[model samples]
Target: MKFQVRCFNIILLVLLLILIYFFFYHLRYIDDDGEPIGTVYITETRGRLDKSILTDYVKDKEDEYFSAANISVPILVWWTPFTYDTGSYTRCNNNNQARCFISNIRKYRDNKQFSAFLFYGTSFRLYDLPLPRHDHEQWSLIHEESPKNNYAFSFESIMNMFNHTATFKRHSDLPLTTQWLASIDDLLDQTYLIDVKEKTQLQTTENLAPIIYIQSDCSTPSDRDLYVKELMKYIQVDSYGGCLHNKDLPENLRNPVETMEHDEILKLVSKYKFTLAFENAICTDYITEKFWRPLKVGTVPIVYGSDQFQDFLPDNHSAISMLDFTTPELLARFIHELNVNDTMYDSYRHFKLYQIISNDTLLARTMSERKWGIHNDRVRGNFIHQFECLVCERIHKTRQDPTIKYQAKFDDYGCPPPTTFDKNGEKLERSGNWYRSYEFTRCQLEVFHELLDQKNYSFTEKDINNAATKRFAPSFRRNEFLR
Candidate 1:
């Protein structure tokens, strides 16, 4: 009887072990999304994203499983920076899910050992030797300034995060550079819109001053100071901050430009009719917050630097272009007229009524000549959050299939040479009209008229006479201009 009881207990134990094995196997191999399940081992040579941040990102994104029958489980494996020994794969080998390794070519010379390798652009230099494309799949990722920082890697695929069209190539034969473009054109989309009744109250508030310019960068490649100085001669531009401090800023607002809070700066700017929005460098599609801020605060932006200003603007009347007028005097005259005429000035504010569009839609429309539907599905957050999330998603997709390959050549993805100038400081034409093309001017006017017609704003002679009664305030005018 004792021998029979002992045999029964051993059989029960064996059955329990079999049940545990089947449970894990079924969970791993289950097909929910029709995608494969596999682990993506990412080992960074130079640390970019913090380990904690990467861990959190992966955990959040783990819901997206890999699609393949062989890949039963999807996992993201990362090596602790500085803690792991680079020469040995003992740590990686221990994990069954460790499929690929991303490391610097210079640091890790043994390319044949790893299943995959990823080369980061910021750390890459032209002098660095080419990474050998052995059995492993090789990929390049770049988000740095191009042309100046060129790479000679014969990558199977390249991922670019720049503000130009994906097909825009400096050289014809250059390989494909995929677009992961970044821009602040979605600022208005993120803002909560006021009701139609409340919008009238917001619009009725008068702009007390003519123009305001707050800049700390006195020296720049574009030499924006010369243009500002010339415009000041004709119009009363209240110069604040370190660049040109003609007027005393409030005691609370006397801090360094960088340290100043966004709300405080916007409060000061909202009092003015116009704001000088000039960029430091004149690069293609390289617009910054200097252009966006004024539009957000209901002030007309007198934009400079970017020749393709229309691309960024909601419409032609959204902002006054420095390139539109031949000289500073002409631009100043236009601003002065707008300041004196209330009806004309109010016309510029028509963009507030229309829904703000995203940069993606704008680019699509410009490239395809057809009106692309507004991008309502854009991820709303800070640039870093959106950018890192995209990178993580792409990495997962690439790791799922080792057969995927992309070609990104140096000349095609590189930045064009800086604009050449003549002896008189005038921009010289190289291949075509570099400044403002005729097509751009025509498009700007057409967009302005279209928006104007939508609003149905027609000013009669009587309306103009009534608007003339309310002139700009004396305090807002410069002491010399008032005299």
Candidate 2:
């Protein structure tokens, strides 16, 4: 009887202890059962909370925000370009997603829960993050520019931090594959079409060179100037602009940076038969106006940029590619042959003059299928506004159903490191590559961790300098990439 009584007391004590553990664990997580989604009591583990996150969190929240899985409206805050909304930001359909947009990060009169924090990848820096991440909040990336903007984005751990992305890759949450070109017509412009007969006459008279090579920024990752220098050995190249300037521009057009969009420059360049469309960095889907401008003004482009550049053009024969030749000499020989042969030259222009394209060209179909405009017609608004709606709709969908995961992958914005050429024709690492990228990121990530640990997003440049006095991690110290 004594043994039975002792067993009953032991079982009762076990039950009491189990109940006590759960009661304190429940207190650890401040529930928002009757408050706005972001409103919560701070946990002691995350260190001292940002006082602002506590005060302004649920400042203007309505009763509808309380205790609901499906948020009718989720606010998205832009991390960069604070205290402003202009251009495309003004034009949005709120009725569609029933969502809100906040240009500033902290202050909002209509303070709904901030479901996603958007970062413009080019403008975003290591010190520019919005910190003290909430359990319910997610991160979104709004950058369509090249990975040259921030090389650290190439790292898998950094990219996975973004829950969604509006990037150039076709698979991103919002694919802005060719946002630079407003429409298909941008590719089909024949405004400056010069007859082959006049073109050849101009070349012979030394009035217009056979090819035009204009680039201001020199010593680039592609080493464009180096290739152009080698190509000049065989062909007649009228080099203008800042790098390898062998000719003079008209007085007004001398400033290469400012003269980029001038009408006079376009008219002058159109007279040339071929344009050197060399990109600063070669990347996938990184085609810019360099390739587009030559095509726009009815000049043949010698494309030396993206590997899959033909996939974005009118036809396979639309442009002369650097990929076909072993060296610059071989490529220049092909150019010289085409320059002398009128029939061959005219053949390249046939598709443009006829206004007909092959069925396989994805350029037209992709442009027509896009939901947003390039500020060309304003039919559906610009890409910036469309990206906002994408975030808004995602927030609503994810809250409505928990199974949908918001994720952005490395391929969405990852760019391979830039390669430089030595005098020996061997590939060398430039400071813009993994060496600098890894070391710089190590320092930046230290500050990032400090920001998260202390809940201080406003860590200044001075703070970063002080914190990063110790450079290079022990794990990465022996790695050649960080050397």
Best by TM-score: 2
Instruction: Note the Cα lDDT for every prediction shown.
Output: 0.45, 0.68
| Per-residue C-alpha lDDT of model 1 across residues 119-145, encoded as one tens digit per residue | 334444322313223333333333323
For residues 1-483, write the lDDT of model 2, one tens digit per residue: 999999999999999999998865444233224222332321211233354553454455454433332323465766654223311122146455445433433433124455777777876776656555666777888777666566667666678788988887766788787776776765566777778888888887866778998888885667777778877877879988888888888899987656665788888777888999988877777787788777777788999877788888877677988767767778888988998898898787776776656667777777878888763444676666677777777777888898888777988777676665544323456433444554566577666776767877777767785666556444355555532
Q: Model 2: clashing residue pairs?
A: none
What's the distance in Å from true for residue 77, model 2?
0.7
- Model 2 bad stretches (over 4 Å): 1-72, 86-95, 108-112, 255-258, 375-377, 424-483
Candidate 2 vs. true structure, TM-score: 0.75
Question: Which parts of model 1 are misplaced by more than 4 Å?
Answer: 1-209, 248-261, 353-404, 409-416, 419-483
The TM-score obtained by model 1 is 0.49
Clashes of 1: 7
Tell me how far candidate 2 lies from the true structure as C-alpha RMSD in angstroms: 19.1
